[model samples]
Target: MLRAHTVEDVRRAEAAAMADLPDGALMQRAAAGLAAAVVDLLDGAYGRRVVLLVGPGDNGGDALWAGARLAGRGARVEALLLADRVHAGGLAALRAAGGLATRDPDDLSAAPDLLVDGIVGIGGRPGLRPEAAAALARFPAVPVVAVDVPSGVDVDTGRLDGPHVRADLTVTFGTHKVAHLVDPAATASGALHLVDLGLDPDELGPPALEALQPDDVRALLPRPGPDAQKYTRGVVGVRAGSGTYPGAALLAVSGAGCGLVGMVRYLGPEHIADTVRTAHPEVVGAGRVQAWVVGPGGGDDAGSMLAEARADGVPVVVDADALRHVDAPMPGCVLTPHAGELAAMTGVERAEIEADPLHHAREAARRWDCVVLLKGHHTLVADPAGRVRVTTTGVPWLATAGAGDVLAGLVGALLAAGLEPYDAASVGSWVHGAAATEASAGGPLTAGGVAVQIPRLVRATLNPSGSRPLE
Candidate 1:
């Protein structure tokens, strides 16, 4: 799992580590790592024109020290000090190594190949200072390498309010920050590189956000035992689709039939049911199921389908149109909604939800007292108690029609396999994303194509050595 700690957590960890080290040792370690990353990005430091946007704090210190190292290695490093009070020691070191420092923006005759943003650290507010923003505007086309994080991003909240550096690559220290993984800020933070400070993971306590890796998902997957039979694995029931959207039922069942569960039982109109049976001949009509997936393309019949699914007293995956009928607490259910659907249910604007999805997803889970899966570029599965898992594995091709329908059925399969709502939603989302990536193969993707690719993706994940790459 990729765990993202808050700004406060990183501060505490840094302070603790600094206490054990000699004076300036920790900063040197960070600087060495930062310089190494920059050199790697430039292919070589020799003769590369590197510009540093220096600020007042330790973030600027890291960049100054790194600039010194780059200068020593033959890179022409120039620092534009954006703040009145800069890190004195770091500036001295850069000057000693033959790097140029200037307070003026137009001092440089030519733009550098790469821009380093050391304008603000994790401690600063969400918006950039006028000087820093102006300095950044001078080099509009240059690819940026942000120190720790892209300056001016809300480190803890992942919100981008005002002027902030858009880094092509951000070199983060120790653990991942919330801004690096969560969206909005994450969008500005192009690519990430972590530099370990040897901090204890146990000391960090719980993370603010967690993203599941392939190994983590592999461990969460359910495998049948020696004595397992078809019924022994688990059965998932689908109560989705209507006359108007018969394809929704087909898409959902396609995901359910990816072999995660023992059986798939879809309940809808006779014509649609027959269509589903024809598409997936292995599917059976409605019977007792361990879990239920309700309300994909359900239209006006969503309320009634939700009522019947609730009567079964099993864990349910509530999605699409059925999200509207959820008024009270649903302890064991998972509610999956896109930004617009969530906004409708909570009376907030879709734009508001998209701006800070982490906050809105958590708030919705708390409000409904159920697991909430807010689908987006980065899918978040937030539990009622406040834990969240963000799935960042999908390709942009996943925006096709009926994708959510496929995801709903996949989550229901995991729920039927006896995973908790949180685990089921997150794990299923991760797998769904991975399947989409495999399906896309750099071209347009279809909803049914995602379902077809699930088995291949899961096989490759669990058995990486011999399996083909999803790409």
Candidate 2:
């Protein structure tokens, strides 16, 4: 899993590391890594011209140290101080290593091979200062590499406020930060690289969210014994589809992983169920089920399955129409709501949720006492306890009509296979996103196409080899 820590958490980790290490040791290590990355970017560092935009903090210190290293490698490097005062030791080290420091406004327009943005780091707001903004505007087309988190971005919330520098690449120290994974600011970070400072995991604490790796998903997958039959794997009951939207049920069942699902039980309209059976012969009429998936396209009849699933102690995935039916707290329930549905569920405006999705998702999860999955660019899975996971993989092409249905079905399969409500939702979201990426391949894709690609993508995740293991 790829873990991401908050800005405060990263600062705490840095403090702990600096306590044991020498005064300038961590900055030196950071500079070394930064210098190596800059050198690799250029075909050869021999005679390349590099410009450093230095501010007044450790970020500027890092740039000065890196500039000194580049000078030793025979590169023409210049540091332009954006502030009156800079890191004293860093400036002295740069001058001692045969590097030139300047405060010339005329040289700001000079087009260099690379520009290093050291104006601000994690301890910065969204907007840039007047002078800093003017300096950045002088070179509109330079390829810039950011030292830490991109300057002028909300390191904690990932929200954008005013003028911000757009970097072609960002090299962050320690582990990943919240801005690197979240949107708005994340869009400004073109490419990312992590520079490890040997931070302790305990100091970093548990990550805010993580994207499950293939091995992680494989380990979490359930297995059946030799004597196991169809029912042992688990049955997923789906109460989706109406006369108006029979295709929703078909797409949901299509995306449901067949290997992990013992059988699919249909509990809806006869005509719609017949259509589902014809498309997928393995599905049968409703009977006993281990889990339930409610409201893909059941516009009005979505609420009936809540009592049914609750009484049976089966985990339930509620989506679309069922979102409107979430009247009270239901145990073992996972509610998947888009911005509109979330607004309806919370009786708040949709714009409010869109403006600040992290806060809204957590609120919904708490109010309903269930797992809430908020759909957006970064899909957030929040449990009733307030823990959250964000999925950042899927392509924009996956935003089609039946896409939510497919995701809902995938979660149902996970729930049936024995996972906690939050894990099943989060892992299902990760797989759904991965499958969409595999199907799109940088091109356009339909919801049905994403569902069709699930089996191959899921199998690849489980075994990685060409063959599947015995269940």
Q: Which candidate is the best by lDDT?
A: 1
Task: State the C-alpha lDDT per candidate.
Answer: 0.92, 0.84
The CA-based lDDT of model 2 is what?
A: 0.84
Report the lDDT tens digits of candidate 2 across residue range 1-471: 778888889889989999999999999999999999899888767888888889999999999999889988888888889899998888887888777788986754377899899998888778899988887888788888999878898887777789988889899898888777766677777688889899999999998766666777777766666788888888888888887888988877876645677888887889988898899888888688888888899877777756566677888899888778789886688999999989877788987677567778888899889999899888989998878888877888888889999999888988887888888888888888888999999999888888888777777887787776764
In model 2, what is the error at residue 143, expressed in angstroms? 3.0
Q: Model 2 off-target regions past 4 Å?
A: 96-100, 305-308, 465-471
Give TM-scores for every candidate, taking all chains together and pairing residue i with residue i.
Answer: 0.98, 0.93
Query: Which residue pairs clash in candidate 2?
Result: none
Candidate 1 weakest ten by summed lDDT: 462-471
Clashes of 1: 0
Report residue 240 deviation for candidate 1 (angstroms): 1.0
Model 1, span 97-166: residue lDDT tens? 9999999878864779999999999998999988788888888999899999999999998888999999
